[model samples]
Target: MIENNRIKYSLAGFFMGVAELIPGISGATVAVIFKIYPNLMTILSKLRIKHLSFSLSSLSKKFQFDLLLPLIFSMIAAIILCSKAINFLLNNYEENFLTFLGCLMIILSLQIINFFKGILHQKKLFIFIFLGTSIGFILGQLDVESENISIFYLILSGVLAFSFFLIPGISGSSMLVVLGIYSPIIGAIANFNFDILIPFALGCLISLLLLPRLILSIYSSYEQSLLYLFSGLIASSGLLLL
Candidate 1:
């Protein structure tokens, strides 16, 4: 039974990891499709490694290693294997990739719109719309051309990029590309540079702790407005990429 559960999770993780590798493919969307979105988010959001004994005990009892370890390991394995292939595709088929990605983003934005019936009634809806669009547009425009990046900047990039990964339609890898760290990060992964990945991973962990809770709160309280704002961001991100 445990083996069966582990296999299921490993497969889920493989799918999520593959989605994470491709630019504009949202891992969160994959998780949602697999019906593990809420539970996975909750587990990661509340993860506390400092209390290792209690945390591990609780996780084993409630979440089950079969459902957690295999998924985590599988994702790490997939990322390591897929990074080079994704990089190759991005380099060779940039235009076609962007075109497909733009259409996907627009479609995802429409799906977000369908989630809210009375989005117009949300207070400051226009402000959120404007804010989201402006943010995406600015990110799309700014190009960090050099790979001589500082550790602080890498951590910041991870925090910002990974935070967006929690959003259903937003892709973290695409965010890294937009931020101009994608190539360097991919190179680092290929070369096995611990310096580049450690800070970024730490940042990712920190954001995982905070963003999920914040998202759940807003989702529960202002689902309409949040969806509206996210739709704008996702649409702009995709359109500008193209």
Candidate 2:
């Protein structure tokens, strides 16, 4: 049973990783689709990166290695293997690709609403959904681009981009684009620029250390409202692509 679960999680991670590489899709969306969002949130929220020891025994005791290890490996493999094909598709057939993605996202949002079965008050639900949709549309309208990026901006980019990844519908790459740091970061990756990478990586670490816990806390306190918000945001993301 454990082995089977490991395989299942590994596959989930691979798909999530690949989805994140796409412009409109968030990895969290894939996590939701795979029914692993709760588990993913729980594990991430309790992450203890500062307490790491070099020993394998301590590592196993400190972390849920069975799940984490498979996710890490599978996601890494997917990023390494699938990026080029995704890029090719995006470059050549962006409209078609985004259309498909938009449809998928909207469908997922409807399913989430259906799951609630009208438990929420209509007015409150509509408000949350509208708020989320507005944010999504605003994000889609942004097209900031930059040539000169400072360490501070790099760090901020790292933090915001990673934070977006944790959100159900927001695209981390889109956040990067909004911050005008996406191109620079991509250039850094392609050219192996440590100056750009170190700060960005630090930002990601900061988000990992802080954002997950905060998200989990908010989610626990407002699961129903947040779900409505996320459903709306995801639907808007799809609309943007369309």
Candidate 3:
């Protein structure tokens, strides 16, 4: 049973990595599809100095080191390794690639709608949905040329991507594309360009470190609004893909 569970975890990591590779997919969305979204977010939230100390202690060592460590590390490794191949594919087959992404976004949007059914007040949420959709549509249409690498922008990307990770249906990768950082990051990985990678990595680390608490706070205080906003964002994102 333990061995089987390990295999399941590994498969989950692989799928999540694949999602991260795609320009319009999110690793967090893959986690949701696999029914492990909550667990992933919970683990990320616990990544702090106090949690590290607790994890090092004998009592928490088994849970932290044995299970969580392997799962998270494997996922990160898989994403890094798969990214190059995905970039190649995207470059070669842009149309087909985008079609697949559009379909996936549609499915995700439906899932968001189903998730909010019977709980949220639709009337109250529609306006937010409209606004989100408008913003997404406008953002999708605008294109920007890449600028010289900046540590500040890298950190900002991390924060924005991390926030998207917590939001259901919104793909962090898609957000990266809109912000014009997706290709550069992929290129850095493909070529082992540390000059571009180190700052981006730092940004991702900081954002992930800080995101959990913010997510938890929002979930605790404004659960309905959060869900509604996420649903809207997802719907808008799907439209953008189309």
Which one wins by TM-score: 1 or 2?
2
Report every candidate's CA lDDT. Answer: 0.74, 0.84, 0.67
Off by over 4 Å in 1: 1-15, 32-36, 49-57, 64-92, 115-130
| Candidate 3 per-residue C-alpha lDDT over 1-242 given as tens digits, one digit per residue, 9 for 90 to 100 | 76766666677778777776665566666665565656666667777776544435663552344556556677888877887777787799877777777777766755754645734646776665666666666756767556885878877776777677665655677667877888887798889998777877787788788887777676667655655565555666665555
Q: The CA-based lDDT of model 2 is what?
A: 0.84
RMSD of each: 4.1, 2.1, 3.7
TM-score of 1: 0.73
Better of 1 and 3 by lDDT: 1
lDDT of 1 by residue, 1-242 (tens): 86776777788788789878776667776665565666777666555655356566766865556588888898899888987877787899988877887887777666756635455455567676677677767766766664578889889888978987887556798778877898878888879898999998888887887788777766668756666676677778678757
Top candidate by lDDT: 2
Report the C-alpha displacement of residue 89, candidate 2, in angstroms. 1.4
What stretches of model 2 exceed 4 Å from their correct place? 119-123
